[model samples]
Target: MTQVNTFQLNSSKDEAQKAAFQLSAPQDDCAVMFASPHSGRHYPDEFQSLLRVPLMDLRRVEDAFIDQMISPVSELGIGTLSAVFARSYVDLNRSETELDSRMFSDGAPTPAGERSPRVEAGLGCIPRIAASGQDIHVRKLSRDEAEARLQEAYRPYHRALTNWLNLIKRRCGRSVLIDCHSMPSLVAGRRIRTDIIIGTRHGASCDEGLARTVENHFLALGYKVARNIPYAGGYCTQHHGRPLEDRHALQIEINRRLYMDEDTVRLKPGFYKLQSDMKALGLSIMNWAEGTRMLNSQRT
Candidate 1:
């Protein structure tokens, strides 16, 4: 399961299929799925022309090679989904309604709730800021253009995820989504010593035992682990994490300093070691799935 594969942004001039995401589907017994939403590197030529900031700035926001880090894990009977389109084009983590009206010429979708802090910060579903901490758009976007990004990328991703999870629930009586991400080593110029941050929306998103299972793996590997300090799960976790309904989600954030150089967006010597450890972790998750399966059978 400890296989390595990189889905590079602008990976080639080969004119690859303009798919929004790359999916390594599970063969059977998909009680678990590991997702890397922000790891996509492909930037559409159309999207590139609309941005004001340099590509490197948007690169800063990526989870980098997280899809590669977990792609190998799919072999262990787990499905994997990685966005091939960069988050700068459309963020998969935010709700579709989380659009900023200020970025559009006519108007963006009217949000259901009061405006959120993310939208105000220019980090909406259709983002205004590249990871470089600068505005991403050179000109105001048309509402139709914004809607197309959602129609093309956002809706499809969530639909696939829903179809997969629902099928797993029907087959296995439960499903768990491990929404994976990588965090910057330094926040506000201060280095973050904690290597992993697990979020379960303060115990509401997932069962405590499931969250603990993920945490213990990183801890055993000698990585510093924290819970819900900076991140307490995003939309994927909140929307799907429902232990009462036999669905669960937990967001895992790995400090990028452990395995990559943030400035260069390149892998470091530490990557191999981390990769091996993650392979072991994936196996443990497969075991956990079997354990839950057995427990469900007994309950029935």
Candidate 2:
């Protein structure tokens, strides 16, 4: 069993010290890190009490078992960071400034200028609705409540992620951050479906070659792959990716219908095959990283 270092938050001041993510270190340190920001299933009792929608309804926003699909990557000597709090509670992928002012009773501390298209879409840092479009809270939250979630959850996850990547870069001279996620099978009115979508903010978040390598790997395996279509990465990918600095970030959106029952959020017969494919992909990524590092060294 993989050892997970979990961080639990309490309802008091002392709980604020706990980190917001569960990290599984690789057996051997490498230049790659995998992060599953939305796969968190741990729902704090406090957050649960505030929910206006059913628990199942709120789970619609979750990436479901996406963390598990990529957890085995640690065995390839790549560290894995997964959130311990659900995205509905506090989206780890969103920027702290992405808070929607309308969702709060006292108004947000930050100005509306920080609001982006995502904030308008009801999918801001503190979401206004579940993935199913159901209201999340019975009433508007206080600004303090929103701040607390960010302090306890959002900030720590990103802090740890940033630290992990920086450490990997210092150790290996370059680092790759793979932001993993799962998308709902039925995206608004789409008959043709892709098995995987790799987003690098249309080549701004990572090297074009790296994104192509990932796309080609999935394609070679007979999986339909797309790049920056409906999804072109999110806050994490855009914020962390610094191609000029040798820090690459890639957002991978897996189609939930391929491996699990999206409604029940359970594994199906195809789960094992998907998991196997992911591990293979992870190895391929590591090999590519090694090759890139060698090429860079030779150039130097």
Query: In order, what lDDT does every prediction score?
Result: 0.83, 0.83
Instruction: Give me the overall lDDT of model 2.
Output: 0.83
lDDT of 2 by residue, 1-300 (tens): 256666543233332345578897754448888899998776777777788888888777788887888877777787889887788888888888888888889987556526688888888888889866878888998988888888888888898899888888888888898999988878666653888999999899998878878988899989999999888999999998999999999999998889888788778888788888888888888888889889999999
TM-score of each: 0.93, 0.92
Q: How would you encode candidate 1's per-residue C-alpha lDDT over 8-80 as one tens digit per residue?
A: 5564565545667777777566688888888888877777787789888888889998888887777677888
Model 1 regions more than 4 Å off: 1-8, 11-17, 110-114
Candidate 2 matches the true fold with a TM-score of 0.92
Return the lDDT, model 2, position 263. Answer: 82
lDDT of model 1 at residue 210? 86
lDDT for residue 288 in candidate 2, whole number 0-100: 80
